[model samples]
Target: MMTTAAPFRPGDATPTATIRTRFPALRREHRGRPVAYFDGPGGTQVPELVARAVADYLIHHNANTHWRYPTSEETDRLLAQAREAVADLLGAEPGEIVFGANMTTLAFHLGRALGRRWGPGDELVVTELDHHANVAPWRALERERGVTVRSVPLDLETGELDWAALEAALSPRTRLLAIGAASNALGTVSDVGRACALARAAGALSFVDAVHYAPHAVVDVRAIGCDFLACSAYKFYGPHVGVLYGRRDRVEALDAPKLAPAPETAPERLETGTLNHEGIVGAAAAVEFLASLAGGAGGPRRERLGRTFAALHERGQALVQRLWDGLGGIRGVTRYGPPPGRPRTPTVSFTVAGRSSDKVAVALADEAVFVSNGDFYATTVVERLGLASEGLVRAGCACYTTEEEVDRLIEAVGRVAPT
Candidate 1:
């Protein structure tokens, strides 16, 4: 469990103005208007601090790990520090953190490793609400290893997991329950703790895809009681890097494919090769940047992070509420997912009548309101929503997102909406 910090009050919150200034991308102008980045769910803009950390590592500490040189030692230390930062971010031990190219790669790697032990008769449970990264990896195990993969149905009306279906899917043959902590397309935050508990009760290990959820909430792996969890740093305000947390025993026991000369340690053995040293350094800097937002709140890094997330979540709730209401009032705008007050992230997906999602996004972009459009790799969710052709226009709120920006997005979207 994370150490409790003082609850975040409005007075304790960092000003959005101050946070905006830290991201250089906010200065960008598009179509003569300042770009209001609503594509944060796809990838957040990196703060200058994170960029500087990456540059500094490349320029000064460019060396391989664990050699007799100062730069090499420094590289090792920086990598370790990166693990420590991600550990605090996910409420796991530093040694349990593994770095890879991205979450998808890590999940696929883990899927292969776990599949080596299971064949026909062993089962894996995936979800229709999950991003295909979580679904496809385990499904690959079916084709390769002959494991029967079951999918938990999605509740279309509520944009939530079908709890009854999920419960029915788990059985004694289940080897693992792979679930996403949140739906990237719909911002539906699943009850992963409950999901993990069910998986545990069924005598199955659980793997959580936290890539979308980590940016919006504080992830406590222990509280979730999952055997493994994966998140991408880029989903937050960091570089393009994936982090995985594994139980020490689970990681050490995996028959992961690695070079014979590679370190046989739990975490390192999971990582395929020499990692992106600079990206990993920047990832740590990203965690530091997030903690710094708590501003003078003295506590452990996790406590500060908890405070920051608490404050940001409050801000996100308001922003999403405004966006939801504004779009609801507009003609031809059909919003998807759970409405405001539901357990969701500060992300919204919608479609404008008579306009394809891409066209709506293009029109919004012309007005300098950048939003993402498409299945967003949560293809199953979109397919389940029966929006296979129209897709979805997604706008996500982040720490730097402002009310003014939210209003601008609404206005821009209004102009594009069919009267």
Candidate 2:
């Protein structure tokens, strides 16, 4: 069992200094300078508590599930606890949580299962702004199951979803709607609740790729009304693992491919083979760490997480605005995604005129300011922006990101920009 950490209070100031100490990677140096990790949209740095939880699981309770042995029983208990932790984070029931290798893998698995019910003339709705993980799976279904796939267009000028196009794409034949809560490349927060409601009205299932949004917002599965949702642990300061939440009735009905002897259950039916036990433990610890930020002792974990994300969202907004303004001021830099005042994650993607994204990222790395370059698996978004060959540079804020780091990144980009 994981021990409770000290509680924190909601509306309290962000404990930036204290939080930075929990991540050892923040101390890393590159090229004789302290490293600044602005590559949070790619993956955030994990906390010490998460690492310790993984290590403890492997060192002490390393065993498979469903056996009479003590270690096996412990493994079962740990998995259950991990489910509950993730459930609290997403406002879902423990039985609704399913663990897998990562978001892409889980999405593909779901596509195969969901496709079993789809056929020719049936449609799957996708978006131009989504990461390929959400697109490719549904497209594959089109080829394998002869299901028709339609896309919702994106408005390049504002970096927001074109809701009118989405409305046109939905029909009674639309079997499922695959959408992203936030664009991984451009950081545009979509109207997921409205999209889900639209799909429901059309008698279609909704699948949400929340891998980018989960780290930044308080996700309520019930509020969104999505039939299925997927997120990655690595995006939220945890080990590399994917979590999927399916409505109980929907999950129970899926004809997922599995072994005969495997436990036939809603979540278990979707999860194939043995899971990464240590990673699951680490994921639970990550959720606990987020709850601790709120500091409401003796309160429900879900309530604490709600408060924590509210505080995080406020702090992230200020940091992101600073980044947006700083980057916008730099000559030759063209920013993408929603502007500072709009609803979006604290992620900024931009390109410098006369410079490739990869070259600019390399220049920043030399100064120990790390940011991601290229399509970031959102190839369609890149192509739609007419940046297929020259992908954009992405910088995102995290729990430990500071104003100094953001300033450093801006300065580095300015120096590297074409004069």
Candidate 3:
């Protein structure tokens, strides 16, 4: 018989009190009020352990790789360990993981490298719901390598992709399919498995942008069957670092541009120049922090992480539902994206009828309820919604987010909603 997955109940495995204490930033106050970070979609607050790991790396193990010195050797070992840690989180092999400055930079680097193999007849498929980081890099190939970038339309009202349009875009000429696992702007989760499967049938390689999805769900590279996937460390409770996971054979075959003397390997071949060694070390610590949320006792790191994310996802869904329902009840407040029961992240975007998004954001900030405003680098989504000029105010929930905090945000937005 198939075994049931480990149980990860909210109160049993990861209580709010136990989880909140781990983040040092939660102690911070804004204008005498304790800060509630509802801006996790932009970047998450780092935990003490992750910060300590960064500092420890810089203080004791700071050096270049492949040297005779002790620090250099330690640096090499730390990097390997970091790779393994990230690999475990993604359910991928260590060699398949590549480190870079951030997801955008890595995407550009990969796009340029991949562009080398294609010419005028090649096409790339992208969706309107994706963040610009996923859209812009492939679009660049159109100008540089005569690539035709085809876009899949989004259902603006539902905040979901048009699957029919997606299928129509994936012709045999489609060289690569670039899609986001979740919409950072609308919180809509796409069917990445379906997208990847369709791309495979069309003989097209698939690249999944999982930056927003990583903190909210479990990622299995093998299960998704994507050729490549990318996410940012800062999007989770880690330092500012970018991670890319390419399939072993695909990564090994890429003609990545690197220094002549650099180590020529699957991951290192894609990674150029000296990396953010401290940040990489802290990124691993962040993954460990997530694993620890499920108590870290019974199983391996990956198993623990699976349990932890399951619990976090359940908690986040509850909080997001409260926020969504609360916002919907307020006067003159127009909420965007899918409703509470839909497949989505713990992110909500909305606009006050008479208030610009920036004005609402500033008003909320005065009450120490921090949130993000504007397109959030999701320009296409805003333009498609016809709110390009005003954009949308976004509030996202993190692991430490409390029900009380969600109530406060709802109360604050109610106060700012146009009469």
lDDT of each: 0.94, 0.93, 0.94
Worst 10 residues of 3 by lDDT: 5-14
Using TM-score as the measure, what is the rank order of every candidate, best first?
Answer: 1, 3, 2
Candidate 3, residues 1-419: lDDT per residue as tens digits?
89885565555566888889998899988889998889999999999999999999999999999999999999999999999999999999999999999999999999999999998999999999999999999999999999999999999879999999999999999999999999899999998999999999999999999999999999999999999999999999999999999998998888888899887878899999999999999999999999889863568999888888888899989999999999999999989999989999999999999999999999999889999999999899999999999999999999999999999999999999877
Writing each residue's lDDT as its tens digit, candidate 2 over 249-310 gives: 99999989889989788778889999999999999999999988874354899988888898
What count of clashes does model 1 give? Answer: 0
**What number of clashing residue pairs does each candidate have, in the order they appear?**
0, 5, 0
TM-score of each: 0.98, 0.97, 0.98
Candidate with more favorable, higher TM-score: 1 or 2: 1
In candidate 3, how many clashes are counted? 0
Tens digit per residue, CA lDDT, model 1, 1-419 = 78986666744867899999999999999978999999999999999999999999999999998899999999989999999999999999999999999999999999999999999999999999999999999999889999999999999999999999999999999999999998999999999999999999999999999999999899999999999999999989999999999999999999999999999998899999889999999999999999988877678999889988988888999999999999999999999999989999999999999999999999999999999999999999999888999899999999999999989999888899877
lDDT of 2: 0.93
Model 3 misplaced regions, further than 4 Å: 1-10
